[model samples]
Target: MTGAPIVHTASGPVRGSWRDAGTPNASAAYLGIPFAAAPVGELRFAAPVPPEPWTEVRDATSYGATALRRDPGGTLIPEPPIPGDAILNVNVFTPAVDDGAKLPVLVWIHGGGYTEGSPASPWYDGSRFNRDSVVTVSLSYRLGFDGFGYIDGAPHNRGVLDWIAGLEWVQRNIAAFGGDPGRVTIGGQSAGGGAVLTLLSMPAAQHLFHGALALSAALADIPADVAKERGERLAGILEIEPTLAGFRSVSESRILKNQPKAVGGRKGLGLLSGLIDDGLPWGPIVDGELVLRPAADALRDGIGADKPLVLGATDDEFTMVADRAPRALRVVPSTALLRGVLRDRGVRRAYLRANRPQRAKGSAAMVGRFVTDHVFRSLVVRVAEARREADAETWVYALTWVSPTKGWACHCLDVPFWFDGLDRERVSDLAGPNPPQSLADDMHGAAVSFVTGGAPGWPAWRTEPGTARVFGGHPQITTTAYDNTLALL
Candidate 1:
């Protein structure tokens, strides 16, 4: 089918192919266009430098360069090849914008452990959001070591650089596609959600995005030294030094393939996942230039007081990570690990007194619950409190509708419901036979509302318990669901 008339991007004008699978009835369309300089060869581990503007318009109909591919079996994904180097790119979906007025903008970031996941993943298709009257956009960023990785002498968090660049492209050109530059809302699940949290605290990111929907993440503190060591190891495997000049001499795919092995033993690290947050050669840094401070700490200090925020998590978030974690955390099986973990958080006494697992499953569940609450739930509270610190609008949520098969509501389970796509996965089918159609409808509508005006029919979270807005089964605006879990945690 013929696509929309060619829209002019800042670099040049381009066109898109019309969609055969657009919104249920209407013809929502897609346009994949490049936005930055290619990061091949020498540009490998450097901070994403800007691309030169083009005189000739590039065809934006096809998906631009995706960093690289990944094997979901491992922790990190490999960087993939794009059409050329122009690494900055965005895929957009819009309802026909004939007589234009400003439309809400939604920029989506796909999740894959900061290394995996592509902007073109089918699950992130923007058709539905487009039909709902929001301008939907997805972009390609650096993956694995190409985007993340802590290497000495290398710039930090190139992935974040890529995201900011995409936003810059949107600000300069999305008006052509019928979107408002001032009303952009960035959001995503898992790592993408984590990115949203990071962007929230970034001063460089302040004016670019006005709102964010963090689906199931707030992961932004990278251990610099550890992460840099990881990058050095990745460098060692490729027989290259961990410096920018050394890494630039290697092949993209080879460098990507050697990613998982760079960290050595998974168990030896003590954590199931090992993403370093070291300042330079690793994760997001506290560099005076890039990241200013720990995002959570900044939020709790009220940095992003004006922007609206959405916070939530699935009940079984641990199920996916714990599918194998049960056997893992259960290792130092003497309850020493549990005690140590709590003590580290400075709440061991309170946790032990509140938690008394009486059965094996309860014991396992307790461990899983502790991890979930410590990592995610605490972050959720942290973000909301940060929003509250600034006296900004913050809505708190708990995805209480547990997946039927697994009692723990687990991570990523909320994606189906949030997308109103519960029927798309077998797990969702098991989570709830018919699943509550109202859950998706309400949640999606609430998202649209939140992006537009800072709310979704629930009260803002106060420093209280059981007051979370549940996202299922008539979707109650209540509290006290996981207070006991918090106490035990």
Candidate 2:
């Protein structure tokens, strides 16, 4: 890929380029092309509008702008990779559109706690997948305060709105890239995984994708009352009235800085400063128009009931979250917390009945497991159960493959393996070398199968409750991965 070329977009003609990596006849790859207008300046805090047509051919060869993001060291990915509103962009890697075959489409959403991430992330390289007969598309949506702020006057869930915009772009232009507008599979991990679920619940998103894969998705649906309370608290923190008009005036900096406080219920549980709800005014609203129904509510009534889902979660979920700080373990007195967690996991009697020393080990293990189950594992269960009850076919899996880094099948271990890009980050002293290639090949193959066929290698998850496959050592069937933890909840 040398310079940028203009690609036709629905709104108008936009500029992009064909990337030529040494990967051999690399498909026409376009990166960082905006799908929606940049939400900046006066546009900030508003529902995203499609980007206007460009006058001349703009350079899309170079990665365009990225939303504000704190890199691994908490710097910012957008500082150099491009800049701002360009964040609402999409990257396409296709095997030539005119080839005449309607190919399967896999659109990827990156994960960063809904705070920091971009389409340019290395793990999302679609080269391998594209080479294997699938047209892969990765995109960047708004992130952090820019994407999820709850300003009164501002629309909520800007990130999701951006996602919808990206999907809409895929609908309008993907055919040119050789993708079937009908056979799209939307997928993501962690927060992105949560987004996959959110999309399922969104009425506006129904026609956008045919299948979904949610990997380690931490789906959190805050009640309307709780979310309102959070809006008030965030407003107070910014010294503004909780009202929308008042909060809208607060700087984006204030909103971003205060978001982490909202993550774990700084004000209260349902009050967590997260996804918008009721009428998601900001993103994917359930206003009976855009969303039609809440995602969780939709699953309950079988509203988005038509689409099948493939959902998976790691065994020790929170270990990855905990990995953020090893020293914090000392303060948490994880040992004591472990005992209570085990008791909470329906193993109080069983754990207590064990020898004292054994009880302690059991408690420790259960604590990590409980945290995992609570934050993410439960979501996988709830989504599956809800789908199954609705008579929908959904596949569930529990990944027991432990990483050499001591992080038990923790967060985001799937993407690299799925995209077969592990070697890029393998030498990081912080984590293990790319998961064993066999594991990567197996996972990637499953994803390929799912996109190509309706199966991901393993048997479909049954609605009989608690039936699933554990993709590890022998890929065997298991029931209620954490029955103890479920009873605890």
Which candidate number would show the highest TM-score if scored against the true structure?
A: 1
* Most lDDT-accurate candidate: 1
Which window of 10 residues has the lowest lDDT sum in candidate 1? 273-282
Task: Give model 2's clash tally.
Answer: 6
RMSD of each: 4.0, 4.9
Residue-pair clashes per candidate, as listed? 29, 6
After superposition, the stretches of candidate 2 with alpha carbons farther than 4 Å from their true spots are 1-6, 12-25, 72-82, 97-100, 243-248, 261-294, 320-364, 426-431, 480-484
lDDT of 2: 0.65
lDDT of 2 by residue, 441-471 (tens): 8778888888877678666667357777676
Q: Model 1 Cα displacement at 7 (Å)?
A: 1.2
TM-score of 2: 0.83
Candidate 1 lDDT tens digits, 1-489: 344557767777676756644445353445567677777656666656566666665666667766655435432212234445565678888776642557889898877657667776555667667767788888878877778777667778788888898899889888888888999999888778888888888888888988989887847566565567777778778888788877777777687667767754243223423322111122365555677778877787776767888877765465344445546555544256466555554465456445454124544565565666666776776677667767777787888676665555666667655655555535344455766777778777888787766676787776453468887633476665445455532
After superposing candidate 1, which stretches have Cα over 4 Å from the reference? Answer: 1-4, 20-27, 49-58, 71-87, 265-282, 323-337, 344-346, 352-360, 405-407, 423-433, 463-466, 473-475, 482-489
